[model samples]
Target chain A: MIHQTSLMAIAIFLFFASTVIGISFYLGRKAKSASGYFAAGGGIHWAVNGVAFAGDYLSAASFLGICGMIAFFGYDGFLYSIGYLAGWIVALFIIAEPLKRMGRFTFADALDSKFNSRGIKLAAAISTLVVSCFYLIPQMVGAGALVQPLLGFPHYVGVIIVGLIVTLIVTTAGMVSTTWVQFIKGGLLVILCTIITIMLLVRGISTAPTDANGKASYIAKRGVTTVELQSMGTVVEPDGAWIGKKDPVTGDMKPAPYVRIKNAAGVVSVWRKDVVKFKDGNPDVTTFSETQATYTVNGKKNVNGLPRGKGEGEADLKPVGYLSKLPNGEKETGSQTPWGFLSTMQKSEAILWANEKIKDAAGVETTVYYQKPTLGSDFMTPGSSPTFKKVREEKFFGKLDFLSLMLALFCGTASLPHILIRYYTVKDQASARKSTVVGIGVIGLFYVLTLFLGLGAMTSGALDVSDSNMSAPLLARSMSEFLFAVISAVAFTTVLGTVSGLIMAASGAVAHDLASNVFKFKLDDFQKVKVAKMAAVCVGILAIGLGILFSKMNVNFLVGWAFNIAASANLPALVMLLFWKRTTKQGITAAITVGMISSLAWILLSAQAYKDVYGWDPATAIVPFSQPAIVTIPLGFLVLVLVSLFTPKPKDLAAVEKAS
Target chain B: MAGLDFKGSGEREKEDAGVVAHNTKLGVWLFLVYVLVYGGFIALAAFRPDVMKQPLILGINVAVVYGFTLIVSALAIALVYMKTCRK
Candidate 1:
């Protein structure tokens, strides 16, 4: 959807961005030491660190992607909310305290503290880089997505801007600035989302929602002028309708049975196609159908034709998603409670959007997005979307895919390098524990609000069917222009907070784990900090390039892959090291290597990747299911146990026993 | 070994060791309880979707109710752990 640039949005965005950059510059002095640069000098108050955890963890994917999914597919998106929040349980209960007690700088520090093995350092560092990079792609992509509608900039410009700002944030003050940025953004995101949810509940559900122009949101059918057909030959083009296809067997062009109307401004808009009838002795009659225009021509690059986006000489894609019928035939329900909202939605008929691809004889493809009036109960179930529809299938592999994703989400949080690094920023194990509780509370509240925000967008009559990620912001726009500006600005910071944290982890791995530990460099505190800042610059550049390159890809699934890899690779090593005394350095190294490679390989070879990323036939994918944690996580544990059984005890074990 | 001892040398280390062991034991038990609850949710969504679609409380179906419960339970358990565990 082409959004007119709003000065309000630009002003609000600049205000937030400048404030964040100001915080980074102010904190630059505190990060002169290695500990300060890497771990905020272990002095972040538990409360601030706790909100920052929410800020760091709630990336663009959480705010934009999940809400968009729920806006389009209802409860399936909420399934992600449930899975994601559950992972914090593992983080708080198992990983938080011990990790803080064990690690000094990075996740690798925690793993290598047991054996101080170079092999362990190398493997863990590589895993950290890989997971961080996988996680970075989606964030960069989301940055671009936001920039387009919010700032009226192209995708790459947004990617570069975020990349540069985050690099500056990380290079200047590292974790200190990163934590403060996250705290501010996280607090704002939760508070603003709560306000939006309250607004939506107060307004309640409406069957016929009007747009900014006071135009009725519903699209009605129109009758077209009759035209004569002559042996499937070329016919004179109609004044308003365009040819959608040529008869496949014949060379004759067929005008798609839709009518176009031009307003006083000469803006041409196409209405939905309904019926095309041919009488033996008379001209053919065509009638256009409901509110949405089904067929959209893929015009020349950046110059879309009528009824797609508001390009030159093109009509705007009508804002979609509203209730076609309310419960008991009521047109609107005003001022509902939270539970009352869900209960009302469970019975109403919502007009959702679905699209299909078709090709003309000229081989130009057109996407036909049409309205689908779905029962609230049906969409409110787990299998409303294609991604999770497998859960409704009888095939074991289908169900297993859903189960594996949940497992990855459950175990993935504690293993994420960025999340693990946050544990070290707090003062002690007690602080770490308290902050996690605080983190869970803040994050949990946001996830709950996402349900309302998404559902509210679904009925807001301002949905962009093509971009689900825009739903939350568009929902905000439906409420008020000021709210839209605030929500978009907050979301932009969401990307910044997450990207800074990931870069911090990546740079720490490169400097502390790879350069200092693995390569046996005798670096002082200043040198370590310098090397890490340089690494931050390099990683920031790489992230910007990847973000731009993968701009066209759907980024929601990449996050799932990150979780799978993080869980499969890091969890077993961290868990065994803390729990099992016999876990040798060789075991930790082997587990990290095997778990990372296997999950990565499985993801690359999985059906979802084949279809979505590689654009290949999914049937030929090697893996039975896309998510690898169900298999690779167990493989990690098994590899560690087997490798440890064969390796000799570390020399430090005897010394430690004697000392004890 | 009942607990892996990776702490540095000191009286503070010994004191933390006991607390860490106590917390780990309690954590593992709470973690298992959550796993059972979460596992039930995934299982029901996958196998018995019909049951998930049935109205459970008020007019909301089992899926929304169960999903909300899962999210609430995580925070609840975390708060429980924070209150009850040795800090």
Candidate 2:
């Protein structure tokens, strides 16, 4: 109800983001030399780089997406934390030293090491731009989301302001400012999150969470229409006519009852009462009366638009726990352990809190059923990642979807060009390795704390179910206004850290690789740096626009697309070039191109895309409904194998330069 | 100059050397490689949990199995690389 915290949070976050921008501008003059700008003269300590790794790695997806997931779904959200931290191993053991031992500024530099093909430079640069831009979208959107509750600013304003600020951070100092900003953000983010988690443990779980209205707000989704009560609950109709239920035997009009909230004691009750729906233009100002009775679930029935054809193992989407169960007769654990009461359904299956009146096939008024997530398995269940929707309504399939998402997250990390570039910022392979270890510790700690933060939010009564993104900040709001302001501000910077790093990588690719080598521009080192700054501005704008466009998509899900693209396009070519000597420029080129294109096409044509982006019927999407990794990663390897065999090996680097 | 031979070929070397004053770019690429591999493992932790889950230490999922294995293995790789690449 208050936009009070928003101003303070915005002011504080702006102060932080802008100060970094000023520092970058001051330090960035030195970065005008290609070596300095690209790698910070390769003198950064592994410790600093290590924390910077956390800054770059902990994107909007990690903060908002993971917190939102944990808040809404129990234990399932922590799975993301574990998955994200695991990807560092691939970078540490498999790719680290050899990659350092290989090439220069871009992933293309390492990739084009042997062949010196312009094709390699061109392709890798393009892939870097695409993946970096994709990743930037979520960061920008996350910035906007945090700003809304924190600063009370409009969504696009948050997006635009963050974009401009990041552009300033990048164009001024390039990697120098980018690194320090991330360094500060990374350190602050983890420490603050750790504090929040501790507070959550101390607070424990509260059975009675007071609302602003001082009355329990009962909400029900009736078909397409939603009825929410300020005090109890309100019901409205589609054609503007309120619907009332008739007594089955008495043939008399009876009002639907909301939960007979008994809050005199500290714990609340979930008893049902009846009231007739009466309308006078504004249906909200109406009265309710008790039903003077209680009803049990005679038989369970499916209520959604589900056409009941599948069996239990096939489609038994059951609820997890009762919102209100009676004492003695009802099995009660701690009122807040979401998983313990998950298996049993409550005695009262349906609580008819409110309904919406809609036109039926005959064009007459009809009422659609309104119910909560059932107690058995349906409540606290995972929803589809756009028809990547596995059997989440069931147990095993839900776990598998969780598995699939984590799989992408882990593999996606090492493959990212921006993160890979950080390895080069530190001196020597040893620093690279040690820096990573520190990064793991920092990132791992933050992830573990996310579980507490999420669970805290889930039980925090402050959650707005309509927007899962609000889980963390809203949870903070329940604790204290000041904590909410700080956490919300930190979350906005979290977007700032990742997006700036991503833009830096994309800019370098365009200026350093695409313009200089591929197009053969004979520019001075200073000119190269100038081009990079311009590229940062361009990439920053694109990121902001896409962030606003995809404002509504879940931050976590949007990141999955970035991961899928990075793993497909970048990893295959990189792995082959390092391990297999037979790899020609043709093969590596084909693999990278194929991996990037195929994965992008699959995700774009994906059923999830059909549902989310194109608004098509999900069932119409024909791919085997799976992560493209199992197919695309290997395809990249295979294309490299086949193309390398078929095409003539390009001239060796020594001979080519001699010829030139 | 003696150890790196700044201008000399290794046991086998390519002749296209544009030797700058420092080894800045090579270091950056190596860092990039580390970042990618690190990212890959993070993805694995997310995607494949059991592989990373070592015994819980003080109720904390330290990712000990993954963490220890990574440190040890990275050390081993660095050792082998230094040994083989010595001039």
Every candidate's fraction of true contacts kept comes to 0.64, 0.02
Error of 1 at A511 (Å): 0.7
DockQ of each model vs. true complex: 0.35, 0.07
Output the lDDT of residue A266, model 2: 27
Query: How many clashes does the backbone of model 1 have?
Result: 1
TM-score of 1: 0.89
Candidate 1 docking class: acceptable
Worst 10 residues of 1 chain A by lDDT: A224-233
TM-score, predicted candidate 2 vs. hidden true structure: 0.71
lDDT of 2 by residue, A543-608 (tens): 889978998876776788888788888887887776666789989888889999988887877677
Q: How big a share of the true inter-chain contacts is recovered in candidate 1?
A: 0.64
Candidate 2 ranges beyond 4 A from true positions: A1-5, A210-404, A649-660, B1-87
- Candidate No. with top DockQ: 1
